[model samples]
Target: METTDFSQPIRQSAKGIIVIFAFNLVTFVKKFFVLFIAFGVSILRSKSIGNVTPTMMVLAVIGVLLIILIIAILKYLNFKFYLSKDDFHLATGIINKDNTIIPKSKIQNVYIKQNFLQQIINVVSVKIETAGDKKSEIEISALDKPTALLLKKKLFRKASSVSEELEQSESIEEPEVFFKVTPKRLLLEGLSQNHFKSFLLIFTFGFGLYSEFKDFLQELELEKHVEGLVELDEATILNLIITNVIILIGVVLISFLFSVVKTFIINFNLEVVEHQKTIEINKGLFNKVSLSLTPSRIQNLVITTNRVKQYFGLHTIAVKQAMVNVKQQKNFNIVALEKEQLDYLVNKLLSNYNDEQGDVAKPRPYFMRISALEMFLFGVVINGLSLAIFGIEMLWINAVFMPLAALYVYFAYKKAYYRISEDFVTIGSGVIDTTTNILEIHKIQSVKLKQTIFQRPRAIASLVISTASKSVTIPYISKSEAISIYNLLLYKVESQDRDWM
Candidate 1:
């Protein structure tokens, strides 16, 4: 394998034209979906004035594809990148020329990925991220695997000699596998994952879609199909219960399917590989992604699990790194790790990391009172909405939620604790699921004391600890305790000679 000189500008493989054209076509289709749906509806609404031939529709789509293909070709022609002494320069733009230069030292990460389309075309995508940008600043979508690897190395200046580069390119050794997830484990993880979000998403999408097509359905007299649903209003209590149970089961099953399919697809054949200086991830089915992580660059480690998962000895750990923007923060989740595997990974990431839940300090009982009040107000809002929207008959819905709220408040107050140690600060929290966030004291970016007017009356304050990854809040604690924690964090951070990044 011959390595290309970095000094020379390089263009993406010609196949980039196809990928770019496909992307634009997809975007155009998504944007004009309503128009397409309306056109279909108009055709379906009447059959007499339907001289709109199928040939015309096919030609219209072809015309759109041709236009997008031309644009993609022009865009591909203008895209080229090269490496300078201490910077990576990219020149791109179709209508107006644009140039971007990124300092090599500022390069945060370089990831190589291949989607289904790219895999078919036998090209990989190389994305270069930096400290200032929320997303990758440079993306080359059509590069051979070797070229992508070479470019990644050059961005990080990993190879010092041409011989080493050529040797690396020619004979690459596979990294040792740290962990490999089995399909059964994936299925269990999918089952154990919290599906509340998925349920809400499916429910919301279904409602919105129904609303969108309600008028069309009415025009087609399709309401007659579901008119049987109204009979439930006049049913016996037992029948109502049975019907409700059936609906609940169907929703839960749908949500579980969505979650399971998503989990399997995203983590298909997942493998964590250990490299000399970094840990790498290789996963995804249709879209293959490979990411490298330097342990020293990690900001925090979060371990999350729930009672259901605990029964099966399963835990999920999130690896968080320093990033300027929260939205752009690169957090990797490795699910379904056993206790021993979790310990091994944690110790490897944080040298000598202790799992001792040292003398923990619980938040003041004022926190409990606060939670109760919030839940009470939430109940009132729910009942009020039920009354306003569905009449007084649906107010019983609040009763069903009251017990859940009480349970949440109980566990929330019970789980809230903070432990400050010589090297780490652990924040324990969550309701049904338990989340343990451990951050090295030296990685603390800043500490803040926040107090609300209500909290001031109780002499309680919150400690907001900010790290490069995200902020953690320990709320409803005594003002004095908050100050002590704040001072200890600052002292530890100031005394450290090591950099967080």
Candidate 2:
């Protein structure tokens, strides 16, 4: 088990201070330019005469620039950051001083970044993100590399100390190994997925290229002077078809090459390493990327297997965790793993489930039927009349509402086909793109039970579980089933101390 001490203050080096000042100075100049130009434009447009005197405009611009410069200087002076035994403090604001404190325990993630300019200056940017508020994250930009590293270590120690103080049962042991795609595995999986998607991509690319370049190709006028006597009557049309096909082929080949190159480059130099309580992945080619995640931070787990992978007895699984302020959910993927490996991974992560747990789930039998009265009223009274008013030529297509009406019945049947256990809910649906969404009880945030008159007679209801990006919906389930799941989710959310997303 790993242990850390939290009672330490953060400090920056002399180089860090200079680099920060330089960065702020550049930012200040840029802001000044924008403000000065905006003021100048306003003054010019609001002049008494159609054209304002150049002298007044120049002086006005200078005055605005001077104010901006002064503000920038004051802002730089006002900004300050300090770390204490159990919290971090930041204060800023030129005219009105503002101070904010973030407890060590509240820090969700600390971001470290460096750009080309920052590298030259031997500085890095550190952003402290929290789970409490969306816009309240604090940033300490352009600090010396050593200072940034020190800050990161300090935060890590603080978090570790807190975990220890909380007396959590789980010992903070270092991970055995960070899982990464081996070169052979990467090649195999990349090629497999590439081949699977290639046909669709080729067709789409070829068609789009033809559509875009048709006029240009035709405008070349080379076809008119063709010497070949392939066809006399339908020569022009044949030539057009041939030209389009050639362009399509070229486009497909080029797209395929591009995909291959991109895949290789992206998966190049991939590395994964785990320290106590944290898994870090560093990868990418030109624009290197790094992702750090902790198991306690996980919000949801998603495992997906494409038809090809399934056919080949392989599976790809991803574990997702919520990251504050980050647009994308942070995910770790295990690609092309065999059934045994996948099972081992899953068992390790969710140790609460037994081997026979998945099979023990039973399908809820309450059936919900869509209200016939509501459907009839909507079809004839609402949609039917609207189409008539709009002068739809093929009104019979609308008049025959079996296709849409059939959906109601099938969805109900599909919902009946699935089952839910105490620990997890499994929803199975879709015909061509068959999918099963398995959500753990602990991952559910808020449960919403929705029903309309259209659904009352059908006895069908929809349950939406609030997640990080979008709510997961289990639709056309029996009212009983919906309520059962809803209650279960509610109990889990209330009982668990972890925040949902």
Candidate 3:
């Protein structure tokens, strides 16, 4: 193990001052946007009233920049981090000092990222995330690439060594490169993205732009002229339809282009490598990101594909990690894989990958019965409400949906299934877009079985399997079956010596 001198505090790269200043400025603006706007307006008013000259305004800007620079310098001076054999320690803050010590075992992920600025400076930001924290426990804004890589390797080594000691075993298997996203595959993935989502995004952006334009026109007292130029009432019905068609085509094109560009940028040169104990992912274009995670840390795995992607024989895999009360979103998802590759990756990455070979268990016949009854009741209530609010005519209109509701219920009941194996449990559900959630049995935090008053009469129960991050439920199963699965999961949780992150 590489030993570092702990007597001296390890400071960030000199480029960190610039990064800190920018970060502080962004924080200041975000926290007090109204204040910033008010300040700007006041300055403009003063200048217009001849109370402040252009030179004075320039001086004010320079003064603010100087103050920010001094604050950044102070922060840089105060901020320091050093790694001990067992723990990583950080000391930060200028006025309110904070000293944090995080044990090696608690560290769930270590990420190195570089934004455009940091990339230009040849420095990367390091984020050390703990198991339960929403944000990184420690963040080094700027570190040389080599230093960051060394620190990451050291921390991971310390963590792995401790685990090996506890288990009294070590695996010397060579790391394998599982998958890499080529430019063509990336383009396919981008094209396969949900068009509805892209359309909505484009619609929102267009609406916002239109609103801003309207506001600008109103400010300039040219609203009437703008309205005259695009008179809606003067257009014929045919002209209106043609115009709308053209607009819709334009919007869809823009949305598609934006989605393709964004996806390409985000997933550029994506690569996935797997070691005996961990999986590492590297990707991104403008802002490069590298992440490492152990299989034990994964709460569940979701493999998703739409009709188009299915036709293309591609799937996107996402792993959910144990995040207790973490509000921040993590971008650890991977995209564009063939079924064979997906199976290979799963087999190599998950300890319980063979669980899929086990017999799949579908919900009992009572599930369909209960679903039908529920749908009928729901329809009755909806029709009743419609009748009360808008008379018999509305009730008749809603009555048309009663059969559709029943069909939906039947499909849902048919799709719901759960399977358990020695080491993992898989829950499969969804109607239009199917989803299968695979979770390691040892990682299950809790298993809940509940029977409603209506369900109890039929001896049917709902089972909820929960992890640190999310819960998966299998509804309308036989009460006895639910109990058996729950007990088995509990046993796995108790008996397994495996660490869940």
Candidate 4:
């Protein structure tokens, strides 16, 4: 009997047709959404159009969908993939067939995910990412859970001799899970989140949605009823305060609910598992996500916390990997972890994990000056808006908010510091939610120096240091100090023989 060879070409699941069809259909609609809306409005306004009734419009949409489905079928039929000992191969495209060959040594990560649609369809997606060319990432959109797992394991293992590989099938060891999020900790993390940011996000989104329905609400006379409830024109100072307090309370409640629900859906059952040479993250509720990462691939370990989170013994950790697509993917976060758990993970990932600090250096007072001016401008805009919209009765808001905002700026300035140690440089910023980013000197890829006209006169500059994963900026530092640090970082990078990846 002959052993089955993976080098032979294989097709993805037939249900890939459905996934491709759905993807293409959504893309098509999004591409022409505004045009379609405009056309529909014109059709409705015109009384002379004979063949453009609502039923006809629906049929037209159906015809477009059918055409998209045909294209998806052709694309799915043309797709083929295979694995060789040294490389992986993919053949795709309908009208123009593309053959892509990727080296096995260059494979960075493999992610398995199931979105809402895929969950309903009972299929999963496998994403194979390389260190370069994010556009070339390979995705198998529709595979059964078992097949996807088998494929992932096969792709992730080290190469072996033909006979040895054949005999050693199912050779991978089980991963040890070192960290998991508990329900109680998750709740505490949600409660300690920056709800002001959530409130702002909700306000921005709601304002945009309200703009779309502004005229409709006016037509229904709902705006007048709301105005009557508030009595903006004739209300006394006490009444005004009561209305504002009620509105503020309502917004606070909504923001709190949004943050808690969002946290649960995103981080439910989050766990970190370890293998011999890699780490795996499994998380998400409605949309399940599994990520595999190598220690050498990680570039940044960022930890964030506020006073409330500190009291709850919680921190949010974000892992930044080399060559990962930030725009296409969400940040890899391990939420609601303790200090000890974080230290273990950091030491495991980063070999030179030193928590010692030499000297905490601050940017010159010019940074404070800039921040104050910016805050002043913000105050002007906010107070101006309040005065214009709500009359002089709202002028007291600045007396209440400005002092608190100024104190926040002062705290942020006090928090901003950079400490360079033997092998790492720590950058700290933020007041309400303090975020610390640790960067290794050996991994520094490039260093940039910049100076504005105002900064140059004062011998001040901004130092921008970039690693394989991300960049960090140290602004409003002395020009000579920035240059000295820049030179030191470059020298360390050159002296080290370590691979940044």
State the C-alpha lDDT per candidate.
0.82, 0.60, 0.79, 0.82
RMSD versus native structure for model 3: 5.6
Highest TM-score scorer = 4
TM-scores for every predicted model: 0.85, 0.63, 0.81, 0.86
Give stretches of model 3 more than 4 Å off. Answer: 1-8, 42-55, 162-176, 204-235, 324-329, 364-414
Against the true structure, candidate 1 has what lDDT?
0.82
Q: Cα lDDT of model 4 overall?
A: 0.82
Instruction: Summarize candidate 1's per-residue lDDT along 9-71 as a digit string, tens digits.
Output: 878889999889888888999999999988867766763235766567778778888899999
> For residue 324, what is the lDDT in candidate 2?
56
| Cα misplacement distance, residue 255 of candidate 1 (Å) | 1.2
lDDT of 4 by residue, 168-204 (tens): 5425565689788998898888888999899998778
- TM-score for predicted model 1 compared with the true structure: 0.85
Return the candidate ranking by TM-score, descending.
Answer: 4, 1, 3, 2
Question: In angstroms, how far off is 149's CA in candidate 2?
Answer: 4.7
Clashes of each: 0, 7, 0, 0
Those runs of model 2 whose alpha carbons end farther than 4 Å from true positions after fitting are 1-79, 92-98, 114-124, 143-150, 160-176, 187-218, 221-242, 249-268, 310-318, 330-349, 353-419, 426-438, 468-470, 492-501
Compute the lDDT of residue 485 as modeled in candidate 1. 84
Cα lDDT tens digits for candidate 3, 383-478: 888888688879666557877886677777777888887787888886545577888887788888888998888889999888877898888888
TM-score of model number 2? 0.63
| Residue pairs clashing, model 2 | 16-144, 368-458, 368-459, 368-460, 369-458, 369-459, 370-458
lDDT (C-alpha) at residue 298 in model 1 = 78
